[model samples]
Target chain A: MTCATRIAFTLALATTALVAGTLAQSQPPARYGLGRPATGDEIRARDIDVMPDGRGLPPGRGTVAEGAAVYAARCASCHGKDGEGASAERLVGRNEGDSFAFATNPKLVRTVGSYWPYATTLFDYTQRAMPFQRPGTLVPNETYAVVAYLLFQNGIVKEDAVMDQATLPKVVMPAHGRFVVDDRKGGRAIK
Target chain B: MKSSRISRRRALAAGTAGIVGAALPASARQNPDTTKVQGPPGREVGARSPFEKPVRTAFSPARTATFTPLQDLDGIITPSDLHFERHHGGVPAVDPQQYSLLIHGMVERPTIFTLAELKRFPGRSMIRFIECSGNGGRAYRLTTPTAELTPQQTDGLTSTSEWTGVPLATLLREVGASPKARWLLAEGMDAAVMTRSVPIEMANDDALIAYGQNGEALRPEQGYPVRLMLPGVEGNASVKWLRRIEVADQPFMTREETSKYTDPLPDGTARMFSLVMDAKSLITEPSYPDKLEGHGWLEVRGLAWSGRGRITRVEVSTDGGKSWQNATLDEPVLPKCHTRFRLPWQWNGGEAVLMSRATDETGYVQPTTAELMKVRGPNTQYHFNNIRAWQVGADGVVRLAGGAA
Candidate 1:
């Protein structure tokens, strides 16, 4: 290798090392095998992801009263009268200390409090892909209210814990401790 | 020693930068072989044309992903109709005229290209296998491996598509990505908003935003309009119904990446983002749910593939993991595509444990569950690519072993 090339590589390595050391927890687009960073318009076109931590949440909130009307109008057919998901899907429920099952029971499948890991996921998932008949139509507040009612059904928060950016991220989940990150490679298998 | 040290350090750095990095060692980077590179076969040479009428099944009417007739298929390219479907909320009906991809993020100029615009660019075709990472979980039990399953259900998780698309690098270059970009978050327009993170270097090299599958418009289930085609990576990373791609400095930690796809290793820590499907093989002809009539002149056949690269060799065992003999691979063992292997077995009505081990061209050999568990520890239920065992009963009944039979 030429001395010039060597120096260029050394600079790249030094830069990469610095980045890898400090930003190891969250590398850029390429680290996770993506190509490049997203542009503002690109992010705007489909930046629907809302973190359980309220990172991508938009500005809005809703009341359980409003949610009842919205649910009946859009979500009731497939999600059932109370978000049970008619033939489409189950919207809530989690029996504590139980693994999630589909055909167990209506009471079992409709408890959002028992199964979902994050409250924000309920909002994000519902907002991004809910109602079945029509998705991505719910306003931010409608999503929050649906999320609030689902939480109340799960016995998680009371009827009053407002489901908004500030309040949603703080709701400690019942099944939060049930998950663990995967750590299983780079060596011989141990019994 | 000083000069040698300099070269070694340089090679390491180059390897780290990867092929898509801004600068590459001129000597190490091979020029793109545009000559042998392919496009959709213009008109089929009398075979089923690229745009043939859909294959029909008189028996059942399950739409979306159809069941491949495993017993009839000679090699690995599943008849397009038979490939499995795992779509969320069913496939969406999209118009090609309305299809366009918007590339934004750390790039100098974000650009949007229509389907026709994407086709105008220099295009290439890849014969790759995109198996769901959880492809072969069924049939650990069953005597007489062939009895494990009917060819359709037993050998359906895998499929090969000769995809045509513009190389991801060409678009990335046009957009002018920044050197600091390390991650790419890919999102699908499906109702679920399936999103995940991909390393940029990988995208810069073998990734393609494929709009065509098997010579036609991308199937809705296969991400019609346009989808991300990441060669040699996990199928999930290749987002179907792709809408937007964002270059970033960190992973988005999408629910699919964090909660669902991750596998738990023997250690308390789980395999957070196991992107590549390890080498795996299954006997297609005489496998479970499939019944063997008699053992006169049995043709031993199976499909073998590796996510890391191409398959170099496959060894078959009539007596389980013991006494492995080489199986002749059908020639043209393309990288990332299913390579068929055949072994003429002379079974004289004896009991046996049937297994196959696939080795990739990268010299990373496929290990048995026993060997894999040695490193990953035990209790790994997901991503199990262990040597499958099929026991043959005296009464000619083949079933899964370990009492699962």
Candidate 2:
């Protein structure tokens, strides 16, 4: 090779090495292996979340009649006898008519019947945190019962309706159609 | 001649007496030294002087939140003790020795990490702000006049801190997250067992499993042993007292995300998962409850921040919204961090209205309350980042001024 060509090749190799060294300094190692692999049983113990399409639901069934008894015995103290709200949030009221008008008025209260858009959220919330004082203590059937009774009181379900994993998702909430996904991305436009 | 000489001697004696009297006080004056006796021995840990403390205000019967004294702070970083707190359930006390975080579902290796084990991995730190979406709830109430409201009562639910932790991306790589996993559910150990679904893309970006705040172990009120820190997101998304994470293909639609944080609109439809806090600014000094002494040569100082990126510019309007001028931004304008801005004004002892507007690096301008209300409607509850105005009266009293939007 000519002397000029050899010098150019040497300079290119040095530059490449420098760039590689900088890249290595900026990137983290792929893995550290600091934590232990979790066992299947360990995961199942805490993986109690349920999705919108009826995923992660435990097998159980409950009727409105059964739920009425459960609500009176365990929930009535906090959620009120008729779901009109006592010490806690009101669970039933103002489900029909213009929701926008009701929401604008500060005196008008927001409840499960008037605001919540998804029925599955009721089951998930009740199962995870309900009866306020004793959370995660109710069995899946009891949770289904409470949800069924609440829905029935809201005029969304019949008095004898039963709620289970298969039937719960099918029960359409009154406010189901009133929720829109967020469309705002950061920009000069307000929307 | 004898009488004149006697009068001159008398005058001389009087002058001597006056000089001696002035010297005596100069020699005897040790008031500061007298009061400067040794103070009590220093304690093992230092504390702010008894006179200095951040005022805390609680909301609701359960005292679920303690608002920070934003008007009282001087810099961008909020002292750890003075950080604002909003807890659905009371703070949980978790022992570092017993603390463990579980990562499962949609992963090649489901892993359990102890506090010590997590710290062994590579760590990263960043200064960021966490603001609750419902920060300006009280401002929306039409009954309360703007003059009656204080900055602490309006926007005290936001605070910034320097957090240190293991990068969540590093930990996810260690456990090997599946490509199909698009979201992850983070659950806390608080009594409510608060849970929120986070997008996987955020985790791989700048998320952290934070264990330190302001250079010390996380405060119990902040999160204790560990917490999730998602930069620039709503405060609730960064779950405190974090315990478990479940990788999944879809959002879990937990109660916190569905029933609570969602924003309602005028069209009867609610907006869900509206997580990012928009650009906002607030004038801290010469604000409500502070009366100017003389109203001349006042330095208008305040803070500006954006969840999307760095604050590019801040403009102050002393004549309400009629005119504007750019304010000087403090140095080290970090992204997703609070930037302190200042403007010098000469108050002419006349009635005036003051307001600030923030424009972020993304070119998103902070909207006026009227503009925000047009889009969000009167029913919207969260993410209220609008131009706030404080009026200075001829009597030198500054009051909040902007009617219901």
Candidate 3:
């Protein structure tokens, strides 16, 4: 190789190594942004997480009796009057019957009370994502009301059971054990 | 950031004012629908082919995407006109002269760039696939076929393009993003006022503010003037007719992200924002309406992709779900890009089912429709990325098959 070409080749090699090293030094992608080294203010604004332990629970309260009224006003039409998975997602319901493993058959199926691992995911997702048209429009109280109504529909909680910041996070759905965080091909895959 | 000079080679692309995508040879154009397509014989101003030219059908308002006769396609890259389209409301008639892109929020300079300004930046052309997360959702039920799934249930997303546009990072830099900017709020111009929040880091990584599609200015259905192109992420997040770019400290928790894009899992919780369509493969040939005519020499072709990464392999099955074989995957297996795969089969003239499955670089194997049903639950409506099956009846007609279709 010519002198200039050799110098260029060496420089290119050095750049590749530096880039690779930098990427390798990064922290593991903490699941749910939970373990990531996030500051308190950043967490408050960006996290939007409602932990199952009720740690991140906002200062709010809504009785199931009160929630029914809230659900009728802010949620019913799209999520079904009772959260029974209408035109929108089947927010409430458990799928019974066979679970699959290795079966390479093609089909699409999923519901709320079957596969999800964390309840916090449900709350976090809803707070940041829902109400197909007017998202993030719900306040903390409304979110609790909707969550309570949904749990009632799934038969996990009694219709009259009031769900507040203290009680909401502790109410675990039955299938929580069924979900193994995808520790399959990686540490993320909970095989 | 180099000097802008029109070279003879780039003139057709840059033919010194010739649009970069207008590089098609204007001559004897080929018929995309026919078995044997012949391009413009030569030296004709309007000559074109499927690769660089699409048959433009006039419309009160033209559709953003056209469907390829699944029967006619051999490999991936549906003839541009034939690619299917799914847009909210409808395609808007955008006047490029009035188009402008506003880039603001958490940036050094909250500036606006007109369509012309964006076009002046250096451009990169890349081939990619954008399948709806739920393209084939209803394949799980076998007993009650039509009773469970509708025709519209299939193919909710379609089309692939050799897109040419400016990298989103370039624009972000020009605007000077602040260190705190983490997510970007993207909005569309359609009636739905389509909106979604994307991680700004992704834009800085490989996203693009595309103004061109398949070698031309934006199609009306596609976001004309400009659209956000986040390769490998979910489709809805790539807002078309992109109107606003607000880089912020966190995701805005928009409607699309909250109410629509998520899939409810089985355990009384929702699988939220499960973006990046899992790896999937489907045979375009020998599929619905494509008759084999009592079996003979048949060449099987299909498209495969993954949001996680490049497709590393594809396997085909002919004897129901009992046996399988690897197909030839066309190279340059680009990440978030469509990879065409093919296989040859001699039909025995009996009842048989054909299917293809793709595996991506991340080793996330494409799940059969049945396997997916197990993980997500049975009431799925969105983000259904599963293997597809095409049943070949004895007489030669093909229909979506059970198990994997």
Candidate 4:
């Protein structure tokens, strides 16, 4: 056979194989195409959730002293003067090692010091909804301050430790080591 | 002569009437007034008879929960208005014309769907029960006297209804969810902006964007315009008044998931995102505060359900936990829906402890309060589903057991 003819035949075989592979990878479309596609601006306005790893932490910084002041002015009315709790949930307690020991006890109060596993959760929850009456009103810095103060109250961080996107996630909660990922599938096993 | 005969006949009739009246009880006497005529026709919108109105009892002042009157209901389906409610924020009155659901994040096409546009998709309906994780929390309190407790207060956070809506999978597919998407953050429109992280697999399985309940438009309290319904999971996961769903590769770790619904364990480690409510059942009839009267023949009735699947078996224990007998489950035992169970009991009017245990399709048996505390510890507040014991006294009073006698 001639060399040019042999090369042309090989090229045709390769092209057919490529076309078949493309067809095999395509999935049947189930699109109804009913709603309009959302724009970038529309998504940005409502994508406000923060993760445990601090992936969505906004740029802000606050000290424990600043957080204390913010807590007194806004959070203390509901959470109590010393975070002991009044009308709302208590935010500070000293039951570090014994929090789970008293799990069934109604008097065994849960607080940031004893129960919460992630410090980043404080910043996320407070920024999203706090001050009970007027939620989402606090600025990012104020939210950081409030979180720093709560952590300090729980003896989790130093009073002067600055809480920002970089350091906040690093502040390991005392209860962090205690939590186990949920292993219970629907079954008779207790765990 | 005619006057004398008439008097004798009248006297005989009067004597017969007196004898009959004396033999009958006062309540059994025929009422002349009620037999007069039929009453007026009903109003345009039908109303439950004044004597038959059953209402929910609110536990908290914020109206955080309005418990269903479980004992008063006959079948599995809870009336739209009578269904139990638990809202982080008060129900908002939403105008359907202005409502829309926004789907974004981790998707090839992020879409904004109007209520009308959402309804245009092929819809599905299923009978399912939505139960708060805190349904049986009150039963854990050992201080409250059981005599004062009612079944409604103990296990009323659960209610079953036929929810109608577009499958959430359809919406996610239509929006073209990215291959990396693993979770979706469902956010509500209430003042609290209640948010929950739902696994994407559940959405693909049977989760719904429910817009109708019990053959009518969704009730205002049940998220009138639209709500996300994750059947068999904790009620909180089925966010009400849903406005947006953001697909993500990781869970958002919202406050509800992190702080509130998470269950604490004996090892000091809390269990996060333990979403599926296990097999649980409660005997509604012959429950607390209901007297047995003479206790000859009592038809014991209750509800059994599981988030995993259908209730396979419900066992009734008349002699406490010592012995268990299988109860008859009503027809149409649906998955993630309440299944009614019945049993016949011949009470001898002596002291007894009656309880029920539910086993679901996955063979998961309902744990006792003691067994639950052994693993979860006494401090764990959420997801308390344990076998409830009703202690009957010789006086025919039935009260919940494990509380102040």
Which candidate ranks first by TM-score, i.e. highest? Answer: 2
**What lDDT score belongs to each candidate, Candidate 1 first?**
0.65, 0.83, 0.63, 0.83
- Candidate 4 regions with alpha-carbon error over 4 angstroms: A1-29, A96-108, B1-36, B143-146, B403-405
Candidate 1 vs candidate 2: which has greater TM-score? 2
Model 2 interface DockQ? 0.53
Q: DockQ of all candidates, in order?
A: 0.14, 0.53, 0.05, 0.42
User: What i-RMS does each candidate reach, in Å?
Assistant: 8.5, 1.8, 12.2, 2.1
lDDT of 2 by residue, B368-389 (tens): 8878888887767798888888
Q: How close is candidate 4 to the true structure, as a TM-score?
A: 0.86
List clash counts for every candidate, in order: 78, 0, 54, 7
lDDT of 1 by residue, A100-163 (tens): 3322232343245654567776777778777665778888988988777777766787876677
| Candidate 2 clash pair list | none
Off by over 4 Å in 1: A1-45, A52-55, A64-118, A154-158, A169-191, B1-65, B140-148, B264-270, B288-295, B361-382, B393-405
Write the residue-wise lDDT of candidate 3 on B1-405 in tens digits.
Answer: 111110112122111344544553444233335456653355635533424422222112535333333433445565555555656556767788876667666776666677877777767888877776655655554454312221223553645777779888877777677888888878776655566778776788878888888887867666787898888877878889986777778765454554457655665445555656677777766566445654466777788887777888899999866788999988777888888888888888898877787888877777777677776666655656667777777776566766534
Candidate 2 residue B389 Cα shift, in angstroms, is 0.9
When candidate 4 is compared with the true two-chain complex, its DockQ is 0.42
- What local lDDT score does residue A29 receive in model 2, on the 0 to 100 scale? 73
* TM-score of candidate 1 chain A against the true chain A: 0.67
TM-score of 1: 0.72
